[model samples]
Target: MTTATPQTATIGHLLRDTDLSRPAYEQLLADATLLKHQRASGTIVPRLLGLNIAVIFEKPSTRTRSAFEVALHDEGAGCTYMDSASSHLGSSESFEDTAKVLSRFYDGIAYRGFGQNSVNELANHASIPVWNALTNEWHPTQALADMLTMMETTTKPLQDVIVCFLGDGHDNVANSLMTSAAILGMDVRIAAPAPLQPDPAVVAAAQDIAAQSGARVTVTTDVDEAIARADFLYTDVWVSMGESEESWDHRVPLLTPYRVDAAMMSRTGNPKTQFLHCLPSIHDSTTALGKKIFNRYGLNGAEVSNEVFHSTASRVYDQAENRMHTIKAVMLSSLASMTQGDR
Candidate 1:
């Protein structure tokens, strides 16, 4: 929470939990807009020019990987993709050693992994820029994508928007969303069961930010109140990808009341109020996993009711595609700042 001025804006620690700052955040939005239009027109320019990046991920990803790969290539940056099957930290060498080595080889490093501490370990030792694709405590990059999509679709400055996230609110995405909303000055709300709401410390931090900005931060169990005036309604998978079946049963019941279905959308009162999900959404049984779960659990229709999710008011895919643009922005701005730092 140092104010992002000309001086403090130069660093890249976003929410402390996530690794991003206002400079990187703003740059990400700009980069996303440029890439979105260019990709729409079937054009690609490598603004990264000759830069090379090493993508180190422990967790498997669909959109996150595709976005980073596409954005880096589009920016004209070389990317070395590494999975756990390949070179891994603490296996072949120390995380410190890998960080030091990759720093000399690549201009920057992107990691999707277990703990915030794990990422901090890399960033602490690495001289080059360290990007957090996802961490146990925060997903800063995804927040950027979410914000960019909201901006593009709503055509409103982030400062004036009202976004409400439902279901399990203590997850990494929720934490990142709260931090980003606080930093950007947007109304942020979380509606979930008491045990499932966001961390008290995180909410307190966001409240301090809301005190400064005009953001109306709310945390409650009342679903109707949360979505009543929301311009955008957002949610992620009820369970994290690798979570166990026990966790699913435990969480599903707790979050049942907070699901975003037709009734939930109606609470917004504005038919144009958009709905967004981070993808791999259980909105339908379109995918193999979704089908199996739908049959096994006798889910009847969908977690979200396909009618609502597939409706014209749903902007889920728009949010999905902006993942690339916002990430591109983070890379370009962070690297460019580093380059400018040399002068």
Candidate 2:
């Protein structure tokens, strides 16, 4: 068996999936797995001792913020949380200024916000390593966690696995998934409406990665064809952050056809097909948004059904938990690279 051995020395900033090579990506997963085991066995060695990290967010978060804080803490690094109201990044002060200021106090900076250019600007201006938590273009951390979850669950090698994503393929989650899957040599397919298809540049980039890795990257309008033999069915909210509430009238109708219900799961033709979602999911008419969606569309769910979301095959929470482990791995590897004069 070929084990992962990432060239940590070469990795500088993790702004996107293209930042690391195939070996590095696999090695990161291997690192995350080892860290997870160490954590479970209560033998986790903190490599980042005495280091301070900043978690800056222009948007609200439940998993990313918690995961970063807990993961950094577990690794013996101090964490500082800066929410939208507290951190005047690009509002009262420029993002470049904030980046320079934060770089002074924090050894590393994690940013989750609206624009890709914003994060890019901070990375360009800051001397320290900058991690892209999320932007309209990509959610690299979530993709890492999702890959970890799939790595743990899949019976075969990573290259043999197939993951099909349904819903608005234009979103960050789908874009990240495509790039990561391509890098890891997993067969990935995205099914969505023509207008909601992934960015052409992202697709082209993933295609380039796929060529070397032997990963098949497919984007299509045919939902059945996309999930035909998929080992995992993945999706995210039809409407995402930075999108207007009024977009529901347009997106809901366009995307409802791609909803992952029991019929859709059955169509995969893989009985063991696992369900994956980057929550908070609209599986039932419980939450206010769920209730509103139900009232407006008369649908129980938007992207995924309650039956699949609550079923034994649902690995969404597992995906959620892996965020901390993989995130810790990212911080450790990035910081280690910096300390060893690799960057």
lDDT of each: 0.78, 0.88
Candidate achieving the largest lDDT: 2
For residues 85-109, write the lDDT of model 2, one tens digit per residue.
8877777999889888888898899
Model 1 C-alpha lDDT per residue in residues 1-343, reported as the tens digit of each score: 2111233234453324334445545655765676677777777555566689999889999999999999888777899999889985757787788889998898888998887887888888888888899977888888888888888888678888999999889988888888888777899898889999999998998888777766778999998889887889988888785678667668767887887888889888877788878777887777776786677765533347688788998888887788887777667666765444451
Worst lDDT run of 10 residues, candidate 2, spans 1-10
| TM-score, one value per model | 0.90, 0.96
**Cα RMSD (angstroms) for every candidate in the order listed:** 3.9, 2.4
Model 1 steric clash pairs: 14-20, 32-325, 46-75, 46-76
List candidate 2 stretches off by more than 4 Å.
Answer: 1-10, 337-343
The residue-level lDDT of candidate 2 at 130 comes to 89
Output the number of the TM-score-best candidate.
2
